[model samples]
Target: MKKNTIVTTDTIAAISTAQGEGAIGIVRLSGNKAYQIFREIFSPSKPIKKYQSHRLYQGSVMNGANTSSLDQVMIAFMKAGKTYTGEEMVEIYTHGGSNVINSVLQRVLKAGARLADRGEFTRRAFLNGKMDLLQAEAVLDLIRADTDAARVQAIKQISGVLSEFISSIKKKLVQVKTNIEVLIDFPEEEASPKQLFDLKFILQAAHDEVMHVLKSYDQAKIIREGVHVVLIGRPNAGKSSLFNAIVGENRAIVTPHPGTTRDYIEEAINYKGVKLVFTDTAGIRSSEEPIEKLGMEMTRSRVEKSDIVIIVTDPSAASRYDEELSIAKEHKDNVIIAINKVDIASKDQIEQAKNAFEDYSVFPVSAKTREGVESLVQGISGPSLAPSIENAPVINRYRHKQALEHIELSLNAAINLIDQQAFPEIVAEEVDSALAGLKELTGEVTSQDILDKIFAEFCIGK
Candidate 1:
């Protein structure tokens, strides 16, 4: 960015309300010329000639040319340093309509403020230091959150969970930095075998802490967004029925014939504060039909890529599941054997399924009747689930994970160097690398292009 272009061309204005009819619509403004334009035409309900920051007044928005009253409204003024952006701000809360609110915004624009760029308001907030980079990312997550679990994770980030974690790592990094400086500055006095041995202890503890956080990342990632569960099995195995039951909606078609669901159907659900992205993929089988073959190949891909795989099987055709169950056992870290159509099966047939898939966690449930179905969800992610994600590190974005991974590698390298009694200079390089990652996470050492990319994803009036 050019030095001259840093502050933007002029004062800006925008319609903050979602474009539609509502009880109220807000026209927001920010910049040096904000109040000057307001004073020229606003006829305050009381004390019309003067205004103060944060004071609300009843008023009528008028076109300066004709003095025509556009709408009845209440205006709220915010002083610099106290508003969303650290600039003078004005909000005109008019009765909502496409015509009146937009007309009022245009009038403000004519008075001199330009229309706001996408996320410019919040961008200004970041420029003014009201919030850090992580919190700004949370703003988007909170807006697009599909489940309560996602919202909760976003709120944790906004409330500084990630910040605190970064701080903890930074504290360790600071100690490592101090040790390196001590060795470099006074090699004769400070660089001794005893000092090196103590430094090893410090590096080991820091490395362990990083590993602990890394171990919990899987749980955190799932809770922050949702676990991707892909259902793949032979057709007529009640796969769609299981999806509908779990989603509590008829999200997928179910019929007595094979290959009824030709593609995948997705649905979101919060299973006790843990969101689940349940997908019903096409049945995995060879077919003469091109679309079905493509779908079957896609199902295989989804099953391989997903965090969890659920294979639905019918008790009547339990013979096919012997091989399927073996595969599930091989990938036991994320596999659930779901035996559907239990309502139609006899007690002996249900028992046979349980015995056949003994190596995997098999659940016998009737998705059509919603009987014993809730248990399957509860087992994977629910209140009764053994592991809880309370205070889990909220690293949902790939950028954050990459940064943390750098920290992990650097810290581990430092630990190895310390163990091997490698030179302090080599250890210092690893420390510096770790510090760079932590700084990037808080955006202390980030490039303008990255910041632009981050904020550019936001909508206008953020």
Candidate 2:
């Protein structure tokens, strides 16, 4: 595998748009041969001597001679030093169809353009100094985001909001290191109390800021990867009904029989811009039947993985749901007591449900009528949902958290050394370690393995 793509002069091509039929599809190529390949295959309507940079030209993709026409396309030529890969680039917008785009890509490849690897386009951009590691990851995040909130976070990261924050902290750390070095150079000039106090303050501030960002990882992950919500209750407790109501579709079967739904079903719903992946599990019950017993086991497994468990209940006989309630109790922190089928129940039954799970936040909902379901959804997705995009540095990646952890530890060590009045040399070393971590965060120093792992998450077209 190539260590870096910066020095390579190979021209790479790929079908840069989604597969299947649409109004338009893009075949993209980058590197030295991009323009050469484009000119060779593309026959413009008007004869032109030289293709200008950043201009779109109407043309036909010719197979070999003028008589053999492939497809009508608009070819864009972007000059080197002003393109995405820091190399010459070409984009062919053809009629959107799998065969059409594939044919164009093959022609570009046959014209000496190599097939781009997964995320090779973005990878080249990163390697060529177009964007840093965090910004490059944002490109993938923006593509994968399922909700508006997640998209906003990704956009902020791409726009360098998070990078700027990290750079600020890094700058301060560098200044602290320089101060320590100055003290180390003159051992005769003992560091004053004021100078030591100043160093301590700076280190503490950086440590606190790191913690602030670290603490947001859970919330960010919930947004980036939608929250897993499981609807669990006893057999015939209306779990499927509630699931259908929330998903706004007839996804799971609804029946009078208790064990009709023997397996789990999942669907995603956007509640106030937050994506909630609600899974309707097999009704939890003590059944002697083999299939039903197997289903109960799956319910338990889903409960363990869920971020929120909505304990669906029949208000008419809420007391009969003790076993399901107990499961909710085990994960009580994330449990939502939803007393379902409220329309048929008496006032006494609703009161009984309230008393039974009074410790949990109980909501009376009628899935068939779609009452109180909206509020329930808001409650489940609200707390962790980011209030706005202005909170830009929401640390979505575990890699970013890991890098911050290393920097935190180094800052902590530096603080301890300063407190003990240890030699400034030792403190400077710890500070340098922290600086190295910052460099790693932004791709100033990255291994081929790391780059491959990050970019491999992208699809080939990216």
**Among these predicted structures, which one has the highest TM-score?**
2
Q: Give the local distance difference test score of model 2.
A: 0.87
Most lDDT-accurate candidate: 2
**Residues 344-459, model 1: lDDT tens digits:** 89888888888888877888888889887898987667532433547756577878878888888998898788788787889899999998998898776778898889988888
Worst 10 residues of 1 by lDDT: 1-10
- Tell me the whole-model lDDT of each prediction, alpha carbons only: 0.79, 0.87
Query: Residue 246 of model 1: what lDDT?
Result: 92
TM-score of 2: 0.91
**Which 10-residue window in model 2 sums to the lowest lDDT?**
1-10
Error in Å for residue 358 of model 1: 1.1
lDDT of 2 at 204: 94
